[model samples]
Target: MEIKAYSRITADKMVVNGSTVYSSSDGENINLTDLYRHLGIDYPKFFKMDNLCKAGFLGAETIIRDAGMDTVTPKKDCDIVLFNSTSSLDDDIAYNNTIEDDANYFPSPSVFVYTLANIVTGEIAIRNKIMGESSFYVLKEFSSSIIYSVVKETAQETSANAVLCGWADFLNNTPDVLLMLLQRTGDGKIQFTAENINKLYR
Candidate 1:
């Protein structure tokens, strides 16, 4: 398998396939609403998503688009494997802070829903109509071995021929996402491996 395309979403920029899609000096937080508008996407549910889901959705969607596709791979052939350093720390902290003070406690169902890191995967899968294996992992730090191993294992265990896998972390209001669309057969631009993954990650 090899990486067909990728998208990197950061504080002030959106890059797809090594080209800068958008850039700004607006500091750390990314404005997902503005990005969705810029992409000419009409997905109404985007507004309801948390930061992590937004980043994952945008990154995956952008890369898949960059790969020149209208019809997605069959549901059973696509898999989503994601990794994050903080898990749902950002959302969890926000939710906790909202209810920390008894005098001004507010428990939002919307906010509560984003407390799971895997929910990002669910949203993306739903959008792409994918029904294959979906998995999420929390790491103290990035590990190419973990990524390579799990992805390879999933491919071996399931009918996955296309895997959307990578690091999508939304922490401190800044998103550092790198979503790679891996295919079992492609141009072979760079053979998928632990070394190559770590190299691209940096």
Candidate 2:
């Protein structure tokens, strides 16, 4: 298997392959909703997710779009594997903050829905009708070993034919969402390897 397409979204820039797709000038966190709008994506549910999910969701959406593989394989053949340092802790803290002091206590289920890291994968799966191995993980930092291992293992699996995987790491006020689409065989520039992943991640 190999990477058919990839996209990286930093705090101020969005790059696909070696080309820049979008760049923000204000130097703030990337406004996911606005970027989604600019991309003509109007999924209302996207607005309901926390920042972590938003980053992952947007990254997956963009990569799949650029790859144009929505119909290349059956829905059940698609998989999504993601990794991040913070998991959903950012949203956990935000959800906790809503009810910490009690004076302004508010516990909203909408906010509570994204307390788990897997919710990011869930959102992408739902949006794309993906029915294969959807997953998410936490790490001390981006590990090419972990990404390479999981994708390689999945490639050897029997069911999955196409996969969207990588680091959707949104944490500590820095967002790094890099998603790569992999297929059994395609016009992939390079084969799947830790070195190739590290090069594109940078």
Candidate 3:
């Protein structure tokens, strides 16, 4: 597979295909919402997403747009495979806080809805109209080998024409996301290898 496009989003900046397309000012604290606004994305549902989902969404959005794959039509042959270390711990802690005390016990459905880490994949799929296979895996740390293996197997098994795969982890308002668009044929110079994935991730 070839990496047609890739995007990285950190707390302070967003990079597309190795280019710093957006960066926060010095000493400025940038959040997902700020990135959304910078991208001029008019999706209102983005506000309802947890930080994890937001991070994943932003990364996926950037890559899709960068690759010129932003279309109203659904990508039925595309798959999404994402990995993270924290899972949904960020939202898990928030949900826990809501019910930790019976005095103010309130289990918010909005917060509870994002308890599953795979919800980030779902959110991205829904927003991008990707009808192919979607999955999320939680590991002790980021493993490019695991990502490459899963993506390869998924593409081969499902006969996927393309795939969106990488890591999206957010905790305590910190975002570390990397999303890559891969296809069997493309003009991209980067080959889909574990070593290359690791290098780009770093």
Candidate 4:
């Protein structure tokens, strides 16, 4: 498939949104509202550790919507595939930090539910009402083969015409996210093979 839209987020210093109010490692508090403004997008309805999953979903949704697509309740078929390196490490940290306090220890279930890497898919699916196949993966860096395989599988299984895949990761406190909506087209196919992903990233 061919990439139609993309968004990247790299926050070195920022406040952890929807999580405990801790200063980001880079000492920069990224106002999600301000971030959206910078990207020329209206903030989404859901924001919050509820952590990276929700944020990545918001990023993907923003890109899709910005592309002038009817993201909400799509009339046509589509799929969502997400990937990351840390696997909700930010949420884990937030949860652990909350329970680490002896005097203030109240870990909420609401927040705990967002500890999964694939939670973004759920958020996007719910927001867009997209009842198509969805999946998530984790890796140290880009995995073009895995991405291509997932999209191919989803398209074949769901009869979808396009797939929105992403590489969203949180490193040390900096959020580095890249979300792309790819359309499955004959002319767009890059022969998503192992030889290419390894070489492309290298």
C-alpha lDDT score of every prediction, in listed order: 0.85, 0.82, 0.91, 0.63
lDDT of 4 by residue, 106-181 (tens): 9877778877778878877776676767888887767767766766677778878667776677646566665666
TM-score of each: 0.93, 0.93, 0.96, 0.74
Evaluate residue 119 in candidate 4 and report its C-alpha lDDT on the 0 to 100 scale.
Answer: 81
User: TM-score ranking from best to worst?
Assistant: 3, 1, 2, 4
Better of 1 and 3 by TM-score: 3
Give the winner by TM-score: 1 or 4. Answer: 1
- The sequence of per-residue lDDT tens digits that candidate 1 reaches over residues 1-202 is 8888888888888988788887755564568778888888878898998889988899988887777654355577888999989898889988998899999988988899999999999999988877889999998888888988988898779868889999999988788898888999999887879998887777
In model 2, the runs with Cα more than 4 Å from the true position are 71-74
- Candidate order by lDDT, decreasing, is 3, 1, 2, 4
lDDT of 1: 0.85
Higher-lDDT candidate among 1 and 3? 3
The lDDT of model 4 is 0.63
lDDT (tens digit, per residue) of candidate 3 on 1-202: 9999999888788889999988888957567787899899999999999999998999999888877786488899999999999999999999999999999998999999999999999999998899999999999999999999989999999999999999999988788898999999998599999999998899
Which stretches of candidate 1 lie above 4 Å from their native place?
26-29, 69-74
Off by over 4 Å in 4: 12-31, 39-44, 185-202
Whichever of 3 and 4 has more lDDT, that candidate is 3
